[model samples]
Target: MHSLSKLFLTFVGFVGLSLASPGGGEDLPAVCDFAALRARWPKESCEALTSIQAGLPDLLRRVRPYTQTYVLVLLDRPDGVPRAWDDPVLSRLRVGLLADTPAETIAARYKFAQVVPYPLSPAGACALFADLHRGKIDAGLVWAPLAGYFVAVTDVENRLQALPVPQPLPPLEWPKSAWEGASASDSDLFRCADRIQGVLESYGVAPAELLTANVEESSVIPDQPPPEDLAAARVGEALYYRYCDRCHGTQAVLGRRGLELRQRFLQLSYPEFIRAIWEGRPGRGMPAYRGLLDKTQIEALYQYLRALTLGKIAPRQSTD
Candidate 1:
């Protein structure tokens, strides 16, 4: 009698699990309701997932079909040992454990093609994520630790959501001061906003509250709030690309003229990097761009140069 009962319970469990599979019983509507998923995951998890799954049918099909490829970018290098930055499993859906469905299988059903990984610096992550936000790729999978750091710095902090994964260890919580009181550098804010924007776009959240403000030249360095405002950063970038790119050559200044300038700053630390632009070395024929370039633009240039020095950006041949 005991054996028979045990067997019956086992059968029932199998049936339940089978019914929840991606294609077998009901489709579960592929998340027709975002709120329900939110209830299942943490606030951070919901934010990350919603942004990636915003345009469901297309994203599902793209990620699942052919290869089921999901692009993951780890800001830190893989030591093969799991660290706080390792969130690859949650980058997609909670699947199997959470919903009794596998993310890969769901992606397969949707026709996902491949899962690719790119290791990038914070700047590279920003550019790549920005491109993804613009629909250059399907979606970007990032580690939550870096994402949290970014959330505190960018304007998107209030606008975006951070999703928690299934069996999540514990959501990372940054000190409110990390994003509040201190004056965050422009590059820091830009990277933060880039992360927030990417997350927001993936979740299908509309950022109506976020506004783009024009950059204003200030004589004194005002005590700007933490996690610099991203909207203003972007505005400053647009202005820089339009006006300064022509003279200074923007991020990709090249030729013998450009090389000479880069060689000079190669040894300087980030602080010196800022100072050289602000105070100007003068003797090098490089004019002080401080007054003309706002704090945000200066950060962007610094980020670009830093990348170039690190060999992340290749300089073009000097025809002149």
Candidate 2:
């Protein structure tokens, strides 16, 4: 009877194990299946998912997804950037954070001499690094992809570094919903928000909140110029602000390394201007705008630059 009881206990344990297994008719939906998640969560939680998925390839491609945390640091010497986490002098330096960064969250993670708030957008990571390079700020926290792009373009990898923020590994938490049995979390949605936040933070010249501002759309250029030229220049100015102005500056004068177009306007003819922008100076960190900006937009940018260079239009002050 004792042996019979032992055998029955073993059988029950085996049945329990089988029922808990994935093949036991209790498998969870794949994490990538948004449709399954949508059915599980409310509609609004999934709204950000589409944009998140759309941008993931570009954002994730730039950094190791396995890296949990990062810190931006300035190299003491050109060769002083530390390769390992335990390297010395890391805690002694002053650090820069995005103006909108939840300082409380970061302060709890690491000790620094001080945390300086930089007014740039997160897309302005390069600009932030430029600040570091110029000694405007000591060190800054930046995303891996932005750091990678900065190093690639400026060839300044040795001059700066991003150290992994040393912390007890925290379990990756995803955005949770109130629905019953909705085990999946909205990690993608948070990542999407992070991407947008990064862009806003790096754009230091303007208020990060202005990204969502509901300003009435009007012609970028006044209605005084020839209608054709006015239309083209206006579109180009918008393109320039969106793509070019961060590094170039409001008047194209404050560019980190970009030529002050106002000063060099006479030296570059329209064709030369177009060629420079279209082809880009690759080794100098200028990306070719050919595929990104179409011929018409490029022309409009050229016209806008020309207008700015020739003193035909006053540079618009950043209201932020």
Candidate 3:
């Protein structure tokens, strides 16, 4: 009986050792080189191993490595409808857009064949959230904060999923000759064009169609305040100090975590500026102040920002 017990213990020890070993007791390469692994295993198996190695910490190196890339994601609906970009029934998908995001920009990026625009305003975002709760639309392109807002307001967890746009490989860098034409070879130009075309293809876009597509240029109307409205500017200055100073800093120099409002106001059209202020970029830490501040107050804020940009109002130095 003692000999049998000793044999059982020996068997358990062997099993444990086998389980801990790479490939379950099979002798495998010590180095986690994907190129080497691919020669021995199936492509998929090799890729899985590569991904696993990429995720695990390199104890010897004592540093983490990660790739930075952005992908166009398809938002999934909570309703019983299929959650895929290529669903035949979902060929005509309505996209929700913030005022800042031009419809042309979305078309250029995603290359959606059939897009019905549903622009989301400050109030409209909440209404859209309600519509999403009832599963009205197939999907909505929303930022992280807006998605969070929807879930918070509607109390739905499985409402949306952001799936990354798949790419077989990283996009090729555009050649310098592609931009500067003074010293460009025909072959170099063709190669750069081909690379760009490949990138568009990865996004499911037809390169030929884009070649002939005409995108309308948005008109910009400069914000010009009358000399008498200096009083309004003063009022705007007070409002800016109270609400915007913390983020925008003095004279909109972009204080801690603050975007350069003066620069943005100068570049963007009047309507765009108003929309940005009213709607705010929820995903980018800017809160919607539609109800918090009235139209007149918002206009005042805009005036002050514009004045600063136009050199009418001098920038105040930070006290800190």
Candidate 4:
């Protein structure tokens, strides 16, 4: 290992004395996992999950699923929580990390032993869990939630075990627009997990839990609702917070200026917006919400977007 990388891991371990591991149940956007990992169903039903289309270029179709395998590695540490990497428990073992994220996410701070250069959807994660349990690989790294979800769905014997990655997770994303005209090599854009879909069919299954969602609507932003749009906007605001906030962001501030809901609502007529929702822009990692949210609910979402675009509600930006 590089001398500086060794020094840094030692430093981060000191910080770990106070830091808590990330929550396994927190909601994540589609890029992390949707029907396959984390997804928020509406008050009534969850729309069926969309499959990666066979016709689209293989890279684009697998983009979202591949996104999760990148960033950090979660290893099985039975003795105690693994802190960065200097612990005697990991001294000789070649630790694993994924490359689905930007190099700087991990490379800037600490060094990892090996980065498996491939991507997987939820199904691939299942195969990996099987591999780990069967001892095909030792000292492996995996997306934390993927491990959690796999255990939840499978792992009947309770044989699988893991220690959460203790550091803060980097902001992992692969919004399709970000790749709109990409010229990067195949390896640069993604390849976060082992390539192993042929052995399992979990790729075709859904991993989302269908719960009876409970909600009454309200804006996460400043909402001085106009009298006529009041009730509808209230419901829409609730929906936005429940489903859209994770990606669109707090108070509707999306990743970039042009992609913000406030901006998109300005140019899109009601029909265009709804159509976009009905037939999601898959290239961008958004899943079609048609079955999950009904017309009435969608119409309410539009009311909220309308209020947002016209400045009826105040906008909020992400602080983290």
Candidate 5:
């Protein structure tokens, strides 16, 4: 149980601290498990949990005296928290700091130990929790909400019930996008727990609750809406990257191709723009993204491209 707790903490840290790329599509910060560990163990018996939020490998030394054999699945940000690695100019960028924990650290912990870092997407995360519920792994750490979703759907027997781990540190709030608009209420949090509990119930595994929940207290960036200027630019950038970056480099598309197509495209009414997207020009191989994007997204893209035409959204000069 101690070993599992330590592993869970390490897993959460890796997910929270990754540095993302700037030009990537909309990305979410991965929600990390931050439930308390001590509540499960008799208060007097358990050692204090090492800080997972520290975002360092050396910190694992506190747990080195424990067992061995760890498979670390590096998590993508799901909570949409602002990462230190995020760029001020462009959003949605992340990269892992420590690819895998030091081999020496693993060796020191157990006579026989192995550490492998498997990067998993959100889809992969769901699949993982499914396996965990089935007793595929000795122990697993995953998003609580997802753990809940899996349990509810699988209807696994209660070999393992979801346990609520209290966080040693103060509670934190992940960004709004974390739950895809799900209100962050006690009910929502418990719903996540219920999902996991359901799965554990089905599997007949007595769910062990951790003592800590390592949630963020506040976002690195405030919750205020983007400035109008910045919002306009973001919309423009998103559209340019998604639709316009194919034929020309972003800068070239914005600075040159945009100029070339200005009058031609402006003459296009909204319906024409929609048509261009829905029905591709066969010769050009410009396929339709009608279903891929919503009306707001499409309009944002339009505003961005239009800004380019007016010379209001030129690409930054290349440092290279």
Candidate 6:
């Protein structure tokens, strides 16, 4: 307060949009707004990550202290580990690194070493040691993982070397926090934020360490709520009203007991349900949904119907 007052600097602030910002209705996480978000991004796959901005940075400052978000490390070519940070043996060697990352900042203070700032897209990862093959840098100063992946693949020829991270671990930007509360819910945003901070605490800041050529985590199946949860039945509920309600009755009420989804679900397995939707019986006046919806959407719709059938959730918003 005194420093800013001495210089007479006025502060102006701006707020960024957040998915978790609550105001309207339903009181659910934005991630649960599946149909709306998917419609907004027709071409992209839907994930809980609304944006890289996860909105934690500023919101957290008011609630708690920020933890170490990254690690800074020393990487040397197989020639061997240099004795010290001020090691005279490292003088005059080009240090290949990405600019402005923890590694670049760490390299700037080197007692005797050369630094090569590899030009790259800030949003993308670069194999830091890939430059060593260009015969330019004698040693590489970079964050882990980026170098780890490249080294994992390229070092098969025994051309590179690993200098173990010093005792305990490499110098990190801050101490890492462990993921805390997995069972937390959207009803308590702060507790949810606490869990988010834990899992993401050690995520790297440098592009190299942050991203890798090989995917560390992956998923083909779309994320969904548990079968017992009402959300799991969302797609089917929507589709039921749009296509099946008129003939089968809203909520598939027993107006036509033979057509009740609950009964049909007991008779037909999930594969049979998928097959019927994919290849609807033309003679029976049922239209195939394949032309109307993608496989994932159709699958979601089926899951929703199954939930309705099992009495896991009462039909919601059913109408004539």
Name the top lDDT candidate: 2
Candidate 5, backbone clash total: 58
Clashing pairs in 6: 68-174, 78-161, 95-114, 95-116, 233-304
State every prediction's TM-score relative to the real structure.
0.23, 0.36, 0.31, 0.34, 0.26, 0.28
Better of 1 and 2 by lDDT: 2
Runs in model 2 deviating more than 4 A are: 1-228
Estimate every model's Cα lDDT from 0 to 1.
0.34, 0.45, 0.40, 0.40, 0.34, 0.39
Q: How many angstroms is residue 43 displaced in model 3 relative to the true structure, after the best TM-score fit?
A: 66
Residues 38-74 of candidate 6: C-alpha lDDT, one tens digit per residue: 2332122212223212222222322222221222223
**Model 6 misplacement above 4 A:** 1-83, 120-127, 164-320
Q: What tens digits encode model 2's per-residue C-alpha lDDT throughout 192-272? A: 434433333232112212322343232232333233466677777887776676567788886655557667656765556
Cα RMSD for candidate 1? 20.7
- The better-scoring model by TM-score among 3 and 5 is 3
- Candidate 1 accuracy as lDDT: 0.34
Residue 281 deviation, candidate 4, in Å? Answer: 1.0
The true-versus-predicted C-alpha distance at residue 165 of model 2, in Å, is 28
Q: Write the per-residue lDDT of candidate 3 for residues 4-79, one digit (tens) a residue.
A: 2332233233233232321234321212222332234323312222222221111111110101111222334333
In candidate 1 the C-alpha lDDT for residue 146 amounts to: 40
Best by TM-score: 2
Candidate 6, TM-score vs. the true structure? 0.28
Tens-place lDDT per residue, model 5, 1-320, is: 55445544444443443323221222222222323322232223222222222221121222221112122111212332221112131132221111222322322333222222224433234334433443333223333333333333332222222222211211122232222211233433333333333332222122122212132222232333233354766776765654555334456443222334455567776656655654334323233343234445655666666666668777645432
